[model samples]
Each structure stands twice: as C-alpha cells, then as structure tokens.
Target: MSNVISAKNLTLAYDNGRKEIIKNASFNIKKGDFVFITGPSGSGKSTLLKSLYGQLKPKEGNLVVGGRDLANIGSRQLQELRTHMGIIFQDYKLINEWTVAKNVVLPLMIAGYSLDVQETQAHRLLKHVKLSEHADKYPLELSGGEQQRVGVARALAKNPVVILADEPTGNLDDYSSNVIWDLMENACQQLETTVLVVTHKIPTIFSLPYRHFIIESKGVYEVH
Candidate 1:
C-alpha cells in the first residue's frame, strides 16, 4: 500500500517561531497500518498530528496527507482534506446537548446520509462500542469511558480513510483503555483504516502490530 501520510523535513513551531517543536522531521505512515507516536509531554507529538490533520501548518518542509499538500492548502481545501480523516481528542469533543446516538451520527449527517441510514449505522456503531444501552443518554450523562466510546463511534461513522487519535485513552481505566485499543485494532482490520495515535505511554506488551515512533531532541525517530 502507498503512503497515506508523508512528512519530509518537516518543522512545526509556535509563538512566532520562538519555540520550535519538531525540526527536520521525516516519516511515512502507509495505508491500513496501525501506528503510535510516543514522546514526553511537550515533545511536539501532538503538533505533528495537527500537521497531519491540517490543524497546524508546517513551519518548513513538506507534509502531505491523503495525497494533498497540507503546508499550503486554502481553508476550503483543508476542510476537504479533513473529510478523509476522523479525529479523536483526549477530552472527547462532543456536544453535551446531543445524545450519544446523535453524536455518533453527526458525521454521517454532515455527509448527507439519509436519516434512515444514519439511524441504522449509528445504532450499529453504538452496539459495536458496547454503548447501545447508553445511546439515548447525553454525553455529559455518561462516564468518560462511555463518552470516549461515543467519540469512537462518531469517528467511524464516516468510514474515514485515516483516523487520528490524540491521547484517546489518556484518562481512562485499564479496562476502558484496553477496550478502546481493541476497538481501534478491529477498525483497522475490518475497515482498513490507517490509525495513528499520539500518546506519552504505550503498554510494554501489545498484541496488535504497530510501529513505534518517538520524538526527542527535536526530531522523530521510528524505533526499529
């Protein structure tokens, strides 16, 4: 499979270039692969992810995602590139007013799926995440784990080609975190989605295959 995300000689910084995060970084994530970006806090793992989703532009070098160059895309074009990606944040970016099912189906609705199809897929995804019983509950009414599962359901609603997760299980218990990992692995295997997760700590033992990439000394290093 070809590269779904490619970064070459990439650099990301903040504060008007006063702070440099990733400098001269290069990496490639192929289609249908499960990968992890691990580093200490403030090492720019999140910034690198932002570049992939076009949330942050590279300060230098080339960053291409889904075959589109992100370093210089217009606003509308960046939005178009994002349509091919699903993002999961640590805080579970969900509307408190919306029920779990509604939250899960938002992507489908935005994609203009019929109400009937949205209902069907939303329910199916909820069931997959073991949140069927909580589908009618609002995001605030559920625990953090449940809300994260809802986020997972929402991310999968669009059948995104690439899924970007930022500390998705950061605040969850072992059970919940393991469940989330299982769900992600299953999605990669079943839907062939390229999954990239940014976290500070990855379990020492894991069954699913994944590449381990670390950021340190102002660069990205893929562990062999």
Candidate 2:
C-alpha cells in the first residue's frame, strides 16, 4: 500500500521556545489505513496530528504527508497540502449561530462547491450521522452526542483524503462513543477514507482492523 504520511527522525517543538515534544520520531501511515494513537496527557500525540495537518512544523528530519515534505513547503504549499485533510476536534466546534446543516456544509462552502452539491452532500452526511431530522437546528440545540455527530458529518464534508480525530470520544457516553466509532469504521471500511485518531487509550475489543501507536520516552511506536 502507498503511504500517505511518513516520518523519520522528526523533531516537533513549540515555536516560542523550540522546546521539543516529540524527538527522533518515525512512522508511516498508509493510504486507506485506520490508526489510533494513545498516550498520557502530555505525550505529544496531538502534536503529531498537528504535524500531519501542517499546523506543526518539524525542526529536524523528514516529515511527509501525501506527496509534500513539510520541511520544504511554504505557506501556500502547506495550505494546498491541507486541502486533502479533515480534522475532528474533541469538542464539537460547530458554530452555534449556524443551523446544523449549515455548519456541516462549512468545508464544502470553503472549497467553493455549488450550493446544490453542498445541500445534497450535507444531507447525505447528516443521514449517515443520523442527524437528518435535526438539520435545521443550531449546534446549541443538540445534546453533546448529537453535536459530536454533527462534527463527524462536517469532517467528512469534503471527502478528505484522511481524517484526523483528537479524542473524539473522550467526552461522550458509551452509547455515543460506540456510535462515533461505528461511523469512523464505516468511513474506513465503506468509504475507504484513511483515519487517525488520538486518544488516551485503545479499547480491548474491536471488530474492525486498525493499527495502534503509542507515545513514550518522547517517541512514537507502533504498539499493535
């Protein structure tokens, strides 16, 4: 399989102080693969995901996403690279003022997709998230689980090449967590979208196939 993300001896750090968070880290995530990252609170899992999305710049070694090397890209090139990625936050970051449908269509709108296509795709995604009936409501009108479902719908809006999720189930109940996992599984199994989720731990039981990475000693390793 072709790799979508490849890292070797990468160093990630904070911009202000150049304080390293992840050092000499190396890994590869293949296209259409489903992967999970887990570690303690300050383990730099989020930092790694930020690097995938170009939000963090590596200070050393090679870090490549899709076909672009992060160390070689300018702002324009970095933005272009990010066009193929989608992100789901731990908190549902939907705009409270916009209707659920409108919020879900934000990415498509940004990409200049036609209104007709936006509506059709948004409805389809909403249906998949089981929120078609709540499309007309605002984010604040939904429960935590429903709001997260809207977040899922929004993340898949552009048919992104990969989806990066950060603690997507951290705040949800078991029922909602299962719903979110099922949606993610379907995205990988049926839609063939690559997925990388950062969480505190991996579950003991899962029916779908996925790789597990863990951060320790300031490096990342494939644990399963």
Candidate 3:
C-alpha cells in the first residue's frame, strides 16, 4: 500500500524552538494501516500527532500527510487538508450547544452537503457508533465515554481518508475504551481508512494486526 503519512528526519519543537520535543525522527505509515503510538507523559506522542494533522509544523526535516508536505503548507491548504481527515481528541471537543446528531452533522455541513443529506449521514453514523438513542441529547448530558463516542462519530461522518486520534481512550473505562477501539478498527478494516492513534497504552485486547511505535528520549521507534 502507498504511504499515507511520511516523516523523514523530522524535528519538532515549541516556544520559538526553546522546547524541543522530537529530534530527527523518521517513520512512514501506509494507507489503511492501524497504528498505535505509545509514550509516557511528556514524551511527545501528542506532538507527533499534532504535526501529522498540521497543527504543529516540523521544526526541521520533512513531514507529509495525505500527499501534502506540512513544512511549507499555507493556512488555506491546511484547512483544505483537514477536511479530508478525521481527528478525535482526548477531551472529545464537542460543542455543548449542539445535540449529538447535530455535532456529527458538522463536518458534512462544512463540506456543503445538503441539510437532508447531512441529517441522513448523521443518523447513519450515530447508529454505527451506537449513539442513536442519544442523538437528541446534548453533549453535557452524556458520560465521558458517551461524549467521546460522539467525537468518533463526528470524525467518521465525513468519510475521511485518514483518522488521527490523540489519546482517545485516556479517560475511559475498559468497556468504553474497547468500544472506541472497535469503531476505529472497523473503519480501518471495512472502509480502508488509515488510523494513527497516540496513547500511553495499547489495549492488550486489541485483536488485529497493527503497527506499534513508541516515543522515547526525543526519538520514535517502531516495535516489532
């Protein structure tokens, strides 16, 4: 398969390069691959994930996602690139004012789908995420796990080519975490969506062949 994400000699830093996180790290993730990036707190796992989604530019070297080189991408280009990607955050990032279905409809709305089409997709995706009963509920009314499930549904609503999840199950119970993992795994296997997740631990019950990478001491290494 073709590479969906590629990093060559990548160096990432923050605060005007005063805080260097990753240094000279290189890796490639192929299309339709399920990848887990693990590291302890302060290890730069999130930093690497941020770079993949264009939230952080490389301090040095080349980083590419969906064939777009992030090193010199413009704001307009970055916005365009994000439309094709699904991103799930640790905090769920749902708009409290919007109901669950509406939140899932946001991406389709942004993509200019008709209201009818948007609602249809929202309903379909919410069902897939097993949140159909809670579609009309506000985000604040749900539990942490339910809120994150909404986030996952929203991310998949656009049928994105790749999904980037940063510590997606960091605050969930085992059952909830497994549900989230199953949804992502299904996307990878059924829809051929590439998934790259940053987390402190990889669930031992994950029952699929996947690539594993770990961040340590300012470098990234793949585990066999």
Best candidate according to lDDT: 3
Residue 141 alpha-carbon offset, candidate 2, angstroms: 0.9
Residue range 1-224, candidate 3, lDDT tens digits = 89999999999999988899999999999989999999889999999999988989999999999899999999999989999999999999999999999999888888899999988898899999999999999999999999999999999998899999999999999999999999999999999999999998889898778999999999999999
lDDT of 1 at 130: 93
- Candidate 2 vs candidate 3, TM-score winner: 3
lDDT of 3 at 9: 99
Each prediction's RMSD to truth: 1.1, 1.3, 0.8
lDDT of each: 0.90, 0.89, 0.94
Task: Give residue 89's lDDT in candidate 3 (0 to 100).
Answer: 97
The local lDDT score (0 to 100) that residue 202 gets in candidate 3 is 88
lDDT of 2 by residue, 85-179 (tens): 87898998889999999999998888889999999998998998999999999999999999999999898888888999999988998899899
Worst 10 residues of 2 by lDDT: 200-209
- By the TM-score metric, which is better: model 1 or model 2? 1
Model 2 misplacement above 4 A: 15-17
lDDT of 1 by residue, 1-224 (tens): 89999999998988877789999999999999999999998888888888788878889999989988888889998877787788898999998988889999988887788999999998899999999999888899998998999999898888899999999999999888988888888889999999999998886556878998999989999998
